[model samples]
Target: MRRLTKFSSAVVGLTVLAAAGTAVAAADQGDDWPYAHHSAASYTLAAVGDIACEPDDAENAATPASLKCGSPTLGGMSAEFATAKQATAMHPDAVALLGDEQYQVGKLTDFEKSFEQAWGGLKMLERPAPGNHEYYPYAKKGDNEAGQNGAGYFGYFNGHDQAGTPETQGQAGDDTADKQGWYSYNLGNWHVISLNAECKSDAFEHDCSTTDSGLLGQETRWLSHDLAANRRQCTIAYWHQATFSATTASTATVPASAPGAGGAEGAATDAWWKLLYQHHATLILNGHEHAYARLRPMNPAGQYDPAHGIPEFIVGSGGEALDTLAGSPGNYDNPNVVTAQAGAFGVMKLTLRSHSYSWDYKPALPGPGFDSTALKYSDSGSGTCN
Candidate 1:
């Protein structure tokens, strides 16, 4: 596995210092911080994938019905990223793991391995949303291990709740301090929300279709009440999985829009989106796609709706093997779709300016594995709905 070198650490440290300086420079220029400023500065948050310390060998196991990366065995494809050490080196203010941070099974031991690796370099900064794997019931018959998917995840992350701090950009209430794992925070001018996908699995057989599932019950109530109460200038929701994807790789893999009603799984999130729109949301970021994609502002139905659309981003390529794009490409086919890139691992960087923000998808360094070019996507000179 690739490890972080002292030199790289120094480089990142220097870059972070430089960014701080730039923020200062902008303040000196006019206090209209661009890119690195406090009021108008940008902070980075990355969404990553089905990270596994032990990848299952397909020859010996049946492939997961929904996961497309094939069976993950011990250690992932990237040797350099053996641990979350690489993520720490990048020095993002915060980091997000989409789901399947472990593998096909959700054992506490397996979670420890995956967590140790994923949180290696980023122990202090890692904030996660539980995936379906984490919620896999521990008592299922015939399953290798009867594990409650998120027990370990919540055990570790729930205690590190810092959502109320100014760094996260929210006023975490008593509920946040108590719930911990499923909380919201504010950093700079953004309200960041971390959700547990396992919440959607509270239904029978741990399916999204389950009404009254704990996942839906808790998050929906929280989201509804929270959105109704938030007064932030910009809201950014980050989670471990995607509620909607234009790709047709696996329907089972796609998250349901609604919690239990299930009219349109993705549509279930409309209430939250409407609340965000009412409060002026800026973006929604997620992982679990094992690839990178950006969607134009659109409604839950994937229809173009500039007046109410919220920009959605799937940045699941962080240090994992990228999944191939599954659907027809280009604007003609998916009008609400903007861009999709497969076959590369990357980090997404957003630079927030006084009037707008610019985002960049920095592919991994060119090698036999993934591409290494920096592709920039901007949503500047545009106004977010309020």
Candidate 2:
């Protein structure tokens, strides 16, 4: 497991330096500032996923017109760039990327040409989770071709060295023999876990069974240990596909048996949900549905459990074309969904405190057929950890 590096430590160091400077300036004025010695009690985190269209997708004439590159533009910039701009403007202490950050095979070239050009500025501040796209090598969904084994995704994050093999560069543990990409870290007072959800990929020989021998099983075991060791008051986990979907459009296009058949991935994650529920996890964030939806807190059984349930936020509206919500406006197929919107690209800003957290969803650009009203669409709320 890769550990949190000097980047996060540098952020803390800078905060201390800033505080020292403020104290010196205050002392020169001969005024005792009560808040001088106290550092900020909360930190801001910006999150989003399902970002960046392939630069060559348009020329290749990909299906579902929305998949074409250079589309859903705003003010002469692509939607991905717009949302990146929005997140950058917030200057959050850290960025939690849910998944599907690079689309259509997630090759290194594609990431460099598309994702890097847009979201690269946040690289140092980002804690990323892998998506199906990062594992699969095919452009179309449900392809049986050999996958990238997370070579591109891990190479990009772990720092690609031309001389080293992908496994040596930490390619989601495909060839690492032991460690997978799942890891945990602390952000302020909150514990953050980034899990690998592409267990069904060919990289692991398609072993996602519930037993301890399967790849996902190993991940679950690690999660159990991680949670047991964690002492933070608030904890959050993020990955690619959600166990509870907020959009029906994803399942509408493919057969239920397909590799990434929307709900199928969700079903496969039941074990994860169960583990998190037992651990009293505060939140789950995911992407893959290409829309944004905030679900009410619920237990692993999908029943509303306000007292001990964990709420989930599906913030897939990073840049790719938005998916249709589960139902008509103001109504939803999933009763647990509190609010959802599909005609905008945006990011979720999370203010994490000691034992509580607040969220603000800001739409940075309009999707196809959406007017200026899309920019006005907003959702904000606060919740306490269990």
Candidate 3:
């Protein structure tokens, strides 16, 4: 196990003094901001997963039944559109897209048509992770998307320069300059990381925890090193699957298209959670379960502790479709879960401070205000970094 340093605390004290300089540097790195003029004292971020609409007819007529398709309501426009609208309304400095940005086999065509239509506006500000759908194999030969290797994902975010064909660019995750989705950046005094979690072949029990599979395993090694070298007081890690799941959704650890729906069985992410917890990571965000669930502070071992623990949030209600919230909040099988709710599509907004963070999550309903029917899944609170 590892521990955070005192020097990180010292740095947080002076974050405001250097916010102006850091913000300018971050923007120059090619990340987008709504406008040039904004406060440097604190930054707001919007994070959600299982986004965009699924691709139904985007495929050919002869596509095999093995490749699933569905008729989304209004082409999944209304649900995803609402979330994107809410995200932009908050005017976040950056939007952390946990994963599953595209659905029903993450084809580039689907991304352009369904995802791009709704959340494409946030592409300039999105820091994304690859989900199982992104790695799903092509339904047929010679299709536009490269079969299941996340070429489309990398191509969209990292750019298509000479680094490597834009599609295959960051799929390697070797910690090189071009490692694509698994990269880190600074937000004021906080250091945030986006990790890739798809491991093993697409038809077996996921080897998500095997840190020796070479390609995806290399990413975890890089994460360990990245944490050891960090000097920031606050840190947040985001990925597609939740390590500690909390609802009735499927959390199978198998290598299927929708493994670990609620994330209860997602031991693949546990390896990374160990590292994050050891370093006293402030927060962990994930998608996959199509509901919003917040867990009580707990250690990597799933034991609760207020003094030294990391809180996890499952904000998968980013659109697509809604999964059931299972039984209830405290009644769930997972002991750490405090709240879980569904039937609403929305985004979680975070106002990241120097050493603390305040989060406000609200999902939009059809007509007026937010969703408050079955459960008041919406939440607002503050927490300090460990």
Candidate 4:
């Protein structure tokens, strides 16, 4: 494989704003590119989301007093380091960070002091999506109605990392990014999309498919055109929220409070999934559940299909904290949910080929709870392009 060259993605020779898959300002052109895939036809990718434990400082608006970094084993600072360490070791062609890269209130100080310390190492190689936390205001507890907004998030990636200048970040994908929080790039033979899932109306968050319009329909429309113009045989769409979830018997006990994974996010809206499925997207990755789940191939209507459906993965366990299983395994009789596990902090690496892809999940050193539990999660397999 050779280094990817980014011509105008919009029109054949146009600079920006093309259908979608073709308008990249710059492709990843990975650090290890050409060398990493020197003699291979595929590229490796490290993908995860809900990353970075709060710094317990100003970045964490709610915990203004807990400035000291907490234990390196659990909810404090363990997951962030572990996941980043694993992703770096793999030397992937690109890292797709689903969302929630920072915690609590996603302040600029948080990204620099906490997230930048870990995952920032892979920022250049990352194709990121904006999470609900990016649009959410800082909340002392319940809903975040007044907070830092996404200034820190946008700036850090755009080279303007500082407080008060939160909006400085501008576009969400990366530098040379667009302000709409969405963009596309090429990786080897695959076309990848980094989308912004936080749709808003009157300064409040809404579902991606909300009929309220406002800032909701932009990405959906862009994605539809992008898919229609994609020339690649395989494609992947990633964002902060999951379009489908794995449910277990004890799931009811698990809080349904995560708005990003629920009504305010993509899974509940189904608009993104509908578009991707219609275009024959190969995979959908998300990180809002704080766990690792891989479901069977399925269509937009929630039915199984061996050949033409999209396979979804909920890999929110990039650190921050671990969430328990959705419920007892028995509660979910749906055969669609192939593998699901909670309390494991790790990263998922994908080997992207011209016409297929394979995934390997490696868990980090045991997090908070080390013993008395059997590790049952094992996700690794390859699937063909749609």
C-alpha local distance difference test of each model: 0.48, 0.71, 0.66, 0.64
> Which 10-residue window of candidate 2 scores lowest in summed lDDT?
1-10
Clashes of 2: 0
Better of 1 and 4 by lDDT: 4
Candidate 3 residue-wise lDDT, 80-160, digit = tens: 888899998887777888888876666656676788887877665676777766775544533433355565566555545
Model 2, 181: alpha-carbon shift in Å?
1.1
The best candidate in terms of lDDT: 2
lDDT of 4 at 375: 40
Inter-residue clash pairs, candidate 2: none
Model 3 lDDT, residue 207, Cα: 47
TM-scores for all predictions? 0.66, 0.82, 0.79, 0.80
Better of 1 and 2 by lDDT: 2
Quality of model 4 by C-alpha lDDT? 0.64
In candidate 2, stretches whose alpha carbon ends up further than 4 angstroms from where it belongs are 1-39, 57-66, 71-77, 139-146, 167-175, 251-261
Alpha-carbon RMSD of each model: 10.1, 8.2, 7.4, 7.6
Ranking by TM-score: 2, 4, 3, 1
Compose the digit string of candidate 2's lDDT tens values, residues 192-229. 88888777787666776645687777778888888998
What is the lDDT, from 0 to 100, of the residue 201 in candidate 2? 81
Question: Candidate 1: deviation at residue 298, Å?
Answer: 0.9
Give the candidate number with the greatest TM-score. 2
| Clash totals for all candidate models | 33, 0, 2, 15
